[model samples]
Target: MQLDATDLKILQQLQADGRISNQELADKVFLSPSSCLRRVRMLEEAGIIHHYCAVIDAAAVGLEVDAFVQVTMRRDVEQWHENFSQALQQWPEVIGSYIITGDANYLLRVRARNLKHYSTFVLERLYKTTGVLDIRSNIVLQTLKDTQQIATSLLVAE
Candidate 1:
């Protein structure tokens, strides 16, 4: 959907605070509450605003380790891709998985309690998977930046 200045403003505010009341959002964007609510509903219906979620601290929830895993497949077949993707979706430790370019066929972002837990995930789950040929993992030491918000400035031209 084509987004005008108001829509962009609404998106920006919602990204910053999804829990903001409709009246508050309207006041911020200089729109009537009814108009603002209508626009938001439109955005949601058009699939622009996919969903709202809370950002929780992984460490606070007993998940201390974050790792990026590069996976290579033995064969570049449709079945292999499907099988791997299905397996990934079922694995709770795997938070994010991407079919990337370059050397690796797939990249996975995983979170675990500790090193031993990560090792078990690799050895028992990933290694035993039929289509998985090789796996390389790099554990994260310190996270500098992590966000789900999109940069609206780039999309909205001045």
Candidate 2:
């Protein structure tokens, strides 16, 4: 779908506040309520606006340890990759997982209560997963920036 400047503005407003009322959103984007609603519905139908969710704080919820784990696989097989992907979905500690072009096959963002809990997950669960050859982890000491918002202004430029 071809998104215009108005669509970009609407997206930016939504990204800032997903729960903003249709009337408020329409005012912000300088459109009628019905038009704004129609545009938003179109964006949703196009899968541009995937889903609305509340962002939670990990530390406030007793999750103190955040680690970036690099996993190397024993075999470069499609089935092994599929199995590993399925296994990740079952592990709640893993918040994010990605297949990247690097020494590791997968990179996982894990959240735990503490270092001990993180270690336990790595030792018991991650290591035991089939085709897992090696694992490296870097625990985050401080989080400088973390956000789900995408730059809609860039979309306008495109």
Angstrom error of the Cα, residue 104, model 2: value is 0.4
Q: What is the C-alpha RMSD of each candidate to the true structure, in Å?
A: 1.4, 1.3
Candidate 2, superposed: residue stretches over 4 Å from native? 76-78
**Please, what are the lDDT tens digits per residue for candidate 1 over residues 1-158?**
89888998999999999999999999999999999999999999999999999988999999999999999998955599888888888899999999999888999999999999999999999988878888999999999999898888877766
Clash pairs, candidate 1, are: none
- Per-residue alpha-carbon lDDT of candidate 2 for residues 129-155, written as tens digits (9 for 90 to 100): 999999999999899999989998667
Model-by-model lDDT, in order? Answer: 0.93, 0.94
Give the TM-scores of the predictions, in the order they appear. 0.96, 0.96
Shift in Å, residue 155, candidate 1: 1.1
Model 2 scores worst on lDDT over the 10 consecutive residues at: 149-158
Distance from true position, residue 127, model 1, in Å?
Answer: 1.0
Model 1 lDDT at residue 153: 84
Question: How much does candidate 1 score in TM-score?
Answer: 0.96
